[model samples]
Target: MARFLPAIGLWGGLALVLVAVNLLIVEKQRVLDDGRTVLLALRPVDPRSLIQGDYMELRYHEALVPADAAADTASPETDGRVVVALDADGVATFRRFDDGGPLAADEQRLRYKRRAPSGLQPDPENSELFIGAESFLFQEGHAEAYEEARYGILKVAPDGSSVLAGLADSGRRPIRP
Candidate 1:
């Protein structure tokens, strides 16, 4: 019985790890199967981290919700959801910081996790809204291929959650495998 205790604990831990990995796989499959495809315009940003490898730091045009435009009813530092409009080309434009509610046909509600005050301050560049999927990591030697990217192909779920599916060129063709 004493020797079995360690075996039981090891199996329990292994089961937990398996469960976690399964959840991750299910979530990714959900995004790929059920998420709505939306394109977000990118303004050139290139980053290379020695430890993390080559990746592109995504800077979306809609990431900046103008200071005067974003309603400040909540505390200066808050996290919630936002509704953004999608143009004909599927590029997202900031609509409003809003309560979690239904949106119009052209709009999508996304989970807004952090409100960086310094970035949200009124400035020439305007207030920036940090949504998830800000950084996209790629293979070490694939940096050159993504340098000319102009849009982020996002698979936004119904709950306003999203995953960066891939990068797209100016012509809207996916530039990755």
Candidate 2:
């Protein structure tokens, strides 16, 4: 019975881990399927990686943290939600930091992280604020397909959690490999 107890513990722990992982996958899948689509204008960066295939560093044109806001010493590092107003085309433009109030009809919330520059950014001297992912990876030969990418399509949940669905061109067409 003592030997069986160890085996039982190991199997029980693995089961718990699997369940937790599966739950996360299920939640993200739900977000991708049912969340509102919001397009964030992209600021182009490098798009080639010889060792790891093609990728694009993503910077949101509409989501830049104001210099003053990033410089605020009161809260040097923070994670919170920011409100954006969606246009007719579903493109989102930053409105303000979320204050836990009701959002306007055209507005949606997006999660963000503000911190010291990681030095990997184009403007490393400035503080950094980012939403979703910092880069998008694609197949090695598909660099050209994403070169004209003008917007990052995000599927955003009601609670401000988001998933980077894909990249879109100027006409808002997905850039498929």
Candidate 3:
């Protein structure tokens, strides 16, 4: 009977891992299907890597939260949410840091992570603020189609979790590549 213990343990651990992975996949799919669409103005930098193909580094215009609003000075690795007010056109602009209060009808929350600046950035003080993804990968020959992308489309859940849906043009139309 002791000989079977190792096999049982291995199979049990593998089953648990698979279940956990599937649950995560289901949660992300739910967010993508049911989350609110928010457009963030983008400042893109195109860079190519021989191994990773083509991609654009995305920087959101509204990514920086006023230093005063980020009152926690103890940790540089804090993660929090920022409230943004959506305009009629569905574009989001920074309003304030999420204070666990109710959001206004036109406002939505976005998750952000704060990290120490790498010193290579132009403005190190504000560079710590990272909102959503930093890059978007595209097929090798399709970089030109995304050159006109002016916004990074995000599907944000009610709890401030977000997924990068895609890119959009100035007119808010999704750019297909």
Candidate 4:
């Protein structure tokens, strides 16, 4: 009975892992298809791993909700929802439609679901940005992932909407797009 119990536990754990991995793969593809393409300046981090697999860490130049803007109610509750509007200069600016701030100069937009606990204030010296999503915060090696991410404006949607979809490079289109 004891030996059987151990085997059952192992198999159960393995099954659970497989299911979780499959879900991640599906979501990855989904984000690729529908998620916004954020072009960020990538800062690579040391790579390491355990049960799942090894992955590169990344940080972004365009990750934060501009510290100056954070004070404004336009900043959604952590991980709430933000529409990233691009200016003619191609800079990506964020605002919550609910908050009703005027859109930036450009009509291009991207959507990012708010992440809680907030992220770091924008520091010019460091081009790194934070992901406020709970999943990003607690994943096993996510710290490294965020540390190495390349930051850039993913893409611009019409009518003040953003893609807020995934973590990867976007097709380049200057800053405003």
Please state the error at residue 120 of candidate 1 in Å: 14
Lowest lDDT 10-residue stretch of candidate 4? 128-137
Task: For residues 42-143, write the lDDT of model 2, one tens digit per residue.
Answer: 888975677867789998884545655545554344687878899998999877778889999999998988656554433324566788878999877788
- List lDDT for all candidates, in order: 0.76, 0.83, 0.82, 0.44
Clashes of 3: 0
What is the C-alpha RMSD, rounded to one decimal, of candidate 4? Answer: 9.7
Q: Candidate 2, 170: how far from true, in Å?
A: 1.1
**TM accuracy, model 4:** 0.43
Q: Which stretches of candidate 1 lie over 4 Å from their true place?
A: 62-64, 67-77, 115-128
Indicate which candidate wins on TM-score: 2
> Model 2, stretches more than 4 Å misplaced?
62-64, 72-77, 119-126
Model 1: how far residue 130 lies from native, Å = 1.5
When 2 and 3 are scored with TM-score, the better candidate is: 2
Instruction: Tell me how far the alpha carbon of residue 78 in candidate 4 is from the true structure, in angstroms, after superposition.
Output: 3.9
Worst 10 residues of 3 by lDDT: 68-77
Clashes within 3 Å, all models in order: 0, 0, 0, 36
Off by over 4 Å in 4: 38-64, 73-76, 86-91, 97-177
lDDT of 1 by residue, 40-69 (tens): 888798978889989999877645454454
State the displacement of the C-alpha of residue 60, model 2, in Å, after optimal TM-score superposition.
1.3
